[model samples]
Target chain A: MELSLCNISYSVPGKRILQNINESFKPGRFYGIIGPNGVGKSTLLKLLSGIEKPEQGEARLDGRDISAIPRKELARDVAVLQQGGLAPVGFTVKEIVRMGRFPYQSWLGGESVDPEPLINEALESMGLTGLQHRRLHQLSGGERQRVALAKLMVQQPRILLLDEPTTYLDIGYQLQLLDNVRAWQKSEGLLVIAVLHDLNLAAMYADELIALHEGKVLARGVPDAVLQPDLIETMYETRATIIRHPELDVPQVMLAPGVIKSNGLLSRSLEAHVRRL
Target chain B: MLLLAVSITASLSMGSAGLSFADVWGILLHQLPWMPDADTIWSRGEVAIVMQVRLSRVLLAVLVGACLALAGTGFQGVLRNPLADPYTLGVASGSSVGAAFLILFGFQLAIGVWTIPIVAFLTGIATLLGVIALSRSNGVMQIQTLILSGVILQSFLGAFVSLMVSMSEGVVNQILFWIMGSLAMRGWEHVTMLLPFLLIGLVILIAYSGTMNLFVLGERQAAHLGVRVERTKLIVLVASTLLTAAAVSVSGVIGFVGLVVPHMIRLIVGPDYRYITPLSAIAGGIFLLWADTLARTALSPKELPLGVVTALVGAPFFAYLLHRRMKDQRGEE
Candidate 1:
C-alpha cells in the first residue's frame, strides 16, 4: 500500500498550519517527520490518518482519495498512534487492545474473524502479555505506549501514522519503542510515518527523514543527506553541529549552547571560525 | 434479576395498605386470564387497590428507573464525563414548567387523559432542541457549549415555573410536588407512555454501545477508530433525550437515579457500555422500586418525594466517590 499527500493545505481561521504540502510514503519503510513545535507536523499526520481533511488537495491511499473511503474501511488499512497517548480510565490492556477490532465488529459485537488470537499475539509481541489484565493507569508511561502499540498491532493496519509516540519516555524507553516500531514495520512490510522531536533519534531510526518547517517540507531525503548542520540550523533557528555516529555511521546533531544568547560575549564568539582539519 | 424480583415482591406486599405476601400473590395470580374470576377471594375494593393502583405504580417505577439509567449511561458516554446524567440537558426544568403551566392556570385538556405528561414530553423535546440549537457553532455542538446552554435553559425555565406557581395559591404545593418529583398516582397510563420510548431508546443505545466505548476515548480517537463521530453523537443525544423526557414526563423529574445508578453499575462491571446499559436498566429498576417502597411506607401514611429519597442516598455516595478520586490523585502524584 502507498500513502501520499497531494498539495495538501490546512488552516484554522487565522492561521495556516500546512501549505500545499506534498509527500508520499512507501510500504516497508520508516519515515520520520521532524520540525520545531507548531509546524503542522501533527496536522499532516492527521490528514494522512483521515482524521482531518485537508482544506485543499487530497490524501490518497493507492491513488484513491482517502475521503472517498468509508471510515471503517479506511480504518482497516490505516492506524494512528497519537501523542501523549490516551488517559487510561480503567480500561484493561486486553480490553483496550481488543477495541482495535472495532472496525471489524458488528452492532451486536460480532467479528468476522476471532480477535483473541490476534490480541494475544499482539500482546506477546509488544511484551504486554504480563500487563494485559492490568488497568492502563496502573502502568508506567512506556508500558502504556506499548499497550497502545499493541492495540495498533491488533488492528493490523498496513499504514501506521505515529504522532510523537515517544514524547514522555526516558532515553531507554525511547529506543525500546522505536526499536519495536522499526522491527514491526520491517516484519509486517508496513509504511510507518512518525513525527519525531529529537533529530538524532529520528536520523537513527527512520530510513528517510522529511524535515518540516513553517508548514512546508524543508527537505526530504536519506538521514545522511537531510541531516546537514546548515539545514538543521536554518530550520530550527539555532546553531548546531552534525557528526557521524562512531558505530552506525549516521549523522548525529549536537546543538551549540547559548545560541539564544542575551550577552555580548557569545555573540562575539559566533564570529570566530575554526579551519577545517 | 433476583434483586428486582425481591424488590417487586416487597413493593407489592408492603405499601400503606397492609397486605400479606399470600394475599398479594393471590391477587396477582387471580388477575391472570387463566385464573377463574369466581375463585377470587379479595373484595372489589381490595382488588382495585392492590392490582390496578399498587401494581401499576411498581411497573411505572421500574420503567422510569430503567429509562433514566439508560439515558444516564448514554449521556455519560457521549459527554465522556462521569458526572453527566439524563437531566444534564435541563429536560426536567422544562417539564416542570410545562406541568406548572397546566396546574397554575387551570388549563383545559384537549388531549383527553394524556394532558400533563404529553405537554411535559413535548416541552422537554422542545427544550432539548433549543439547547442543541444554542450549542451548535458552525454545525458542531461542542461539549462545553451544550453543557452551558443546558444550565442557562434550566435557570430560564425554572424562573417561569416559579413565577407561574407564585400566581396561584391552591396549586403551589401541587406544582412544588411536581418539581420535587413523585411517582404517586402513576398507573398504566404512565407506564404505556414510557414503554415505547424506553424500548426504542434502549435498543438504539445498546446497539451503539461499542461506539460509545470508543467515544470514551475522546472524539478524535473514536473517529479514527471507524466511528462516524458526529453522526453517532447526534444519534446518542437524540435517543438519550427521548429516554429522559419520557421518564420525566411520567415521574415529574426524579433526580439522582440517573446520576447515581450508572455510576454504581460502572463500579461493579467495568466502563463497557454493552454491559453497563442493560445491567443499569435492571439495577436501576431494583433501586427505584426499593426507593419508592421506602418513600410511601417509611412513615406509613405520609409519603416522601421520590427525589428526596434518591438525593438523600445518592448525594453522600457521590461525595464519597469524589473524595476517593481526589485521594487517589494525591496518591498518584
Candidate 2:
C-alpha cells in the first residue's frame, strides 16, 4: 500500500505546526523524518497514521482519503507506536504484545486473531522470547523498546509510524532495532516511517530521508541527496563535514567546530571545536 | 464452581433465625418428605422471617455486591486507575442527596415509597452526564479534570444530604438507618426491584469487557486501536453509575465492596478486564454474603450495619494492599 500526504497543514490555537506538507511513502522502504526538537516531525507522522486529522489537507491510502475510512479499517492499514506507549503496571511483555490484537477482535462473540503464533513470532523476531513473561517494569530501557517494537510487529500493519523509537537505546541497540525493522520490512513488504534525531544513523539506515526544520520540509530525497554537508550545516546552524562510509559508501556527518568569536575577537578555537567534533 | 456452590448453600442456610442445612434444603425442595421439616418447629413467625425475609436479604446482598464490584472493575479499567471505585466519581453522593431530598420533601406531595429510588436513579444519571459534559473538551475527557469535578460534586451533594438529614423532624431514625445501611427490612420486593437493573448493568459491563482491556492502556492508545474512546467512556460511566444508584437506593450506602473487590481481582489476575470483571462479580457476591452472615451471627439479636461490616473487613485489607503496592514500587526502583 502507498501512503501519501497531500498538501497537509496543521495548526494549534496559537501557532501553525505543519504547513502544506506534501509527502508519499512507498512500501518495502525504511523512511526517516529528521528534525530538531519541536519541529512537528511527530505531528506529521500522526497525520499520516490517521491518529490526528490534518487541517486543510488529506492523507490518502491508495486513492481513497484515509479520513473517510472507518477507524477500524484505518487501524488495520496503519499502526502507530508513540514514544509514550508505556505498559501499565504488572503488564507482562507477552500481554502487551497480545494487545495488538485489539483492532482485530470484535466487541462480542468474535474470535480474536490467533495470537499465540503471532506473539511467538514477534518475540522471537525481536529477540525477546526469553523475556516474554517478564513484567515491563523489570526490563531494561533497550529491552522495553524491543517489547514495544514486538507489539507493533504483532500488529502487522501495512504502514508503521514510529515516533522516536530509539530515544532511550544505546548505539548497539539502535542499530539492532533498525536492522530488525529492515528485515521485517523486506519480508512483510511494510512501509516503515520513523522520526529519528541522529542524522548519521538516519543516513545509514533510511532508504529515504525527509528533513524538517521549523515545521516545514527543508529537504527530502535519498540519503546522498538530502544529507549534504551544506544542507546539514544550514538546517542545524552548525558547521559539519560529510564523508562517505568506508564499507557501505553512505554519507556520514562529522561536525566541524572551526572557530569561535568571543567579544568580537577571533581566537584559535579549533582545539575546543575538535574536542567537541 | 464448587466454592461458589458451597457459598450459595451457606448463604441459604445461615441467618438470624437459624435453619439447619437440612431444613433449608427442605424449604428449597418443598416436595422432599425425608428432609427435616420446619413448620412451627422453629416458630411460624421465625420461619417466615428466615425463609421470606433473610433469604431475600442474602440474595439482594449478593446481587448488590456483584453489581458494585462489576461497576467498580469497569470504572477502574476505563479510567486506567486502580484507585477508582464505582462511587469515586460522585455518583453515590449525588444519588444520596437525591434520595434524601425525595424522602424528606416528597412526603408532602403524597409520593409513594418508590419515589425516592426513582429520583435517586435519575439524579445519579443526570449528575454523571453533567460531569461528563463539563469535563469533556474537543472530544477528549481529561482524567484529572473529570476526577476533580467528581470530587467537587461529591462535596456539594454530601452537604446537601447532611442539611436534609439535619432539618428533617421525626425522621431522624429513618435517616440514620438509611445512611448507616442495613439489611433489616430488605425483602423480596427490594430484591425484585434491583434484579433487572443488576442484570442489565452486568450484561453491559460484560459486553464491553474487550474495550475495557484496551481502555486500561490509556485513551489515546485505545482510540488509536479504534476503540471509540469517548463513547465507551460515556457508556461505562452511565452504566456503572446506574448500577451504583440502583444498589444504593435499595441498600443505602453500602461502601467498600465496590472499591476493594476489583482491586483484589486485578492484583491476582492482572489487568485483563475480561477475567477481572467476572471474577470480581463472583468474589464480590461471596464476600458480601459472608459479611452479611457475620453481621447477623457476630452478635445475637443485635445486627451490625452492613456498611460497618464491609468497612471493618475492607479497610485493613485495602491498607495492606496499598502497603504491598508501595513496597513493590520501591522494589522496582
Candidate 3:
C-alpha cells in the first residue's frame, strides 16, 4: 500500500504548524522523520494516521483519500503507536495486546479468526510472555515500550505510524527495539514511519530519511544523502560532524563541542553572515 | 450474585412491617398467578405491606442502584477520569432540578407520577447537551474542557436547585426529601421506569467496553485504534445520561451509589469495563439495597434519607480511596 500526504497544511489559531507539506511513503521500507522539537513531525504522523485531518489537502492511502475511509476500515491497514506509549492504567500486557484486534471484533467482542496464535507470537516477540498478566504500571519504561511494540505487532497493519516510540528508553533498549522493528519490516514487508529524535539510530535502522524543519519537508532521500553535515546544521541550528561508520556505510552524527553553545554560536554567526551579504 | 440475592431477600423480609421470611415468601408465592388456588395464610394488612409496598421498594432499590452504577461506569470510562460519575458530570443535578420544579409548582398531578421522571429525563439530557456544547471548541472537546464544563454546569445547577427550593413555601420538605433522595414510598411504576433504561444502558456500556478500555490510554489512542472518538463519546454520554436521569427521577438524587459502587468494582475487576459494568450493576444493587434497608430500619419509622445513609458510608470510603491513590502516586514517583 502507498501512503502520501498531498499539499497538507495544518495550523492552530495564530500559528501554522505545517504548511503545504508534501510527502509519500511506500511499503517494505522504514522512513525516519527527523527534526528538532515542535517541528510538527508528530502532526505529520497524526495526519497520516487519519487521527487529525489537515486543514488543506489530504493524506491518501492506496490512492484514496484517508478521510473518506471509515475509521474501522482504515484501522484494518493502518496502526499508530502513540507518543510515550501506554500510561500506567490497570490493563495487563496480554489484555492490552489483545485489544489490537478491536477493529476486527464486533461490539459483542467476537472476532472471526482465532487471535490467540497472533497474540502468542506478539507476546513472545517482545519477551512479554511471562509478564502478560502483570499490570502496565509494574513494568519499567523499557518494558512498557516493548509491551506497546507487542501490541503493534498483533495489530499487524500494513502501515505503521510511530510517534517517538522510544522516547523513554535507554540505549540498550533503543537498539533492541529498532532491531526488532527492522527485522519485522524486512520479514513482513511492512511500511514503517517513525519520528525519531536520535538521528544516529535513524541512520542505522531507517532505509530513508524524511527531514522536516519548521513544518516543511527540508529533504527526503537515503540516510547518507539526507544526513549531511550542512543539512544537519541547517535543520537543528547546531554544527554537526557527519562521519561514516567504520564497519558499515551509514553516517553517524556527532555534534560540535557544547551542543547548545555551538547551536547559539552557529545561529548567531549565520545571522551575521546573512547580514553581511 | 449470591450476595445480591441474599440482600434482596433480607430487604423484603425486614421492612418496618416486620414480616418473617416465610411470610414474605408465602405472600410473594401466593401473588403469582401460576400458583394453584390456595388458602390465604397472611392477613390483608400483611399482604398489602408485602406485595404493594416492600416488594416494589426492594425492586426499585435494585433497579436504581444498577442504573446509577452503570452510568457511573460510562462516565468514568469516557472521561478517562476515575473520579468522573453522574454527579461529577452534573447530570444527576440536571435531572434533580427538573423534579424540584415539578414538585415546587405542584405539577406532580399534571401528568400523574410520570411528570417528574419524564421532565427529569429531558432536563438531564439537556444538561448533558449543554455540557457537551460548552465544552467543545473548534469542533473538538479536550478532556480538560469536558471535565471543566461538567464542573461548571454542576455547580450552576446545584445553586439553581437551591434557589428554587428556597422560593417554595409548602413543598420545601418534599423537595428536600427528593433532593436528599429516598426510596420510601416508591412502587412498581418506579421499578418499571428504571428497568428498561438499565438494560439498554448496560448493553450499550458492555458493547463499548472495548472502546472504554482503549480510552484509558487516552482519547487519541482510542481514535487511533479505530474508535470514532466523538461518536463513542456522545453515544456513551447519552446512554448513561438516560440512566442517571431515569434513576434520579424515580428515586430522587441518590448520592454516592453511582460514585462509590463503580469505583469499588473497578478496584476488584482491574478497570476492565466489560467486567466492571455488569459486576457494578449486581454489586450496586446489593450496596443500595442494604443502604436503603439501613435507612428504613436504622432510624426506625423516622427513615433516615437514603442519600444520607449512602453519603455517611460512602464519604469515608471515598476519602480512603483518595488517600490511597495519593499514596500510590507518591510511591510511584
- Give candidate 1 regions above 4 Å deviation: A259-277, B108-110, B317-333
Query: Residue-wise lDDT of candidate 1 within B191-253, one digit each (tens)?
Result: 887899989998999899988988877888787788888788889989999998889888888
Interface RMSD in angstroms for candidate 1: 0.9
List of clashing residue pairs for candidate 1: none
lDDT of 3 by residue, A65-163 (tens): 998899988888998887788898788999999988888888788888999999999999889999999889888888888888888788789998889
- The candidate maximizing DockQ is 3
Give the per-residue lDDT of model 2 (tens digit) for B1-333. 466657766777776556677766656565357756677355676567656876788888888888889888878878877678888788888778877776677452356667667777778877888778779888888888888888888888889988998999878667666766677766788889988988888888888888887776677777677777778888888788888888887887888899899988877787777888789888888888888878877896888888999999988987898788789779867
Cα lDDT tens digits, model 3, B1-333, are: 988877887789996678788887777787779974334577788888877888899889988889998888898888877788887778878988888888888898798768887888889888989988998876787778888989999999999999999999888999888889899777888887788889999988988887888888888777777889998998998898888988888888998888888888776567788889899889888888888989999979789999999999888987787688778768866
Ranking by DockQ: 3, 1, 2
The lDDT for every candidate, in the order shown, is 0.87, 0.80, 0.86
Once fitted onto the true fold, the runs of candidate 3 whose alpha carbons sit more than 4 angstroms away are A258-277, B37-39, B317-333
What are the per-candidate TM-scores when only chain A is compared? 0.92, 0.89, 0.92
Q: In terms of lDDT, which candidate is strongest?
A: 1
Least accurate 10 contiguous residues by lDDT in model 2 chain B = B106-115
Provide the clash count, candidate 2. Answer: 0
lDDT of 1 by residue, A164-234 (tens): 98899999999998999988998989999999999999989999999998788999999999998889876
Looking at candidate 3, what is the lDDT of residue A23? Answer: 79
Supply candidate 1's per-residue lDDT for A273.
28
